[model samples]
Target: MKFTRNASANWKGTGMDGKGTINTESKILNDAQLSFKTRFADGVGTNPEELIAAAHSGCFTMQLSFILTEAGFVPENLDTKAKLAFEDGTITTIHLDLEAAVPGLEDTQFQELAQKAKAICPVSKLLNAEITLTATLLS
Candidate 1:
């Protein structure tokens, strides 16, 4: 199967004084505001790094579930956090932290699966920056 997603942004006026809105085809984000203050200084609304992190976290979580199921393990719960680091106007790194509860799964097995997901997930492969993963198995 093949799929595509699209999001568009429109900005007007100068960088410091201008404002923009982002809209996604899914409509989950409708006319979301973004500006220089929002990107650098911490104002209201979402920014690019925030959106990237959300996508990474969501994709990694789903990939982990698929890997666990394929290995005959049922995933009870999986929580993933993606931290994106931006420096000098460039995205430097992405860190993924995963907390998982899987019944009847050993630490070694869980770690292997998490590592595979981190390496092979679609979003992970698409990123050019460094990617790190920390997996914790919860009882």
Candidate 2:
């Protein structure tokens, strides 16, 4: 299977004055010079980490749902959070915290399914960082 999205950025002057745009249609990018914290990059605007978080959370939940359904269970609630941590001017790691409630399934079964999802999710497979999944089953 293959999927792709393209992004582009333009920068000038240095850390403060540079800006860019994100074009979803062109698979290109938006202004990213100021980053998310600054208005130069809109909060709702596009950046690599936020996009990665969205992908990870969405894919993880979907994969978990499918696996649980195949195991004869339905999810009560599923929440996935991804935190991208940077260090030394590089993406050091992406930490995932996932909580799930699957009715009619044992804790062991839920954990197994969650683990499987973590292993097989597309974003998880694409990232080289250490990904962690924390799943909770609530009746």
Q: TM-score: which candidate is best?
A: 1
Please report the TM-score between candidate 2 and the true structure: 0.77
Least accurate 10 contiguous residues by lDDT in model 1: 40-49
**Model 2 spans > 4 angstroms off:** 1-15, 26-46
Global lDDT for candidate 1?
0.93
Best by lDDT: 1
Give the TM-scores of the predictions, in the order they appear: 0.97, 0.77
lDDT of 2 by residue, 8-64 (tens): 555455555445554454534434333434433355455667777778989999998
- Rate residue 97 of model 2 by lDDT: 84
Model 1, 1-139: lDDT tens digits are 8998899999999999999998999999899999998899889988888999999999999999999999999998999989999999888999999999999999998999999999899999999899999999999
lDDT of 2 at 81: 87
Give candidate 1 regions above 4 Å deviation.
Answer: none
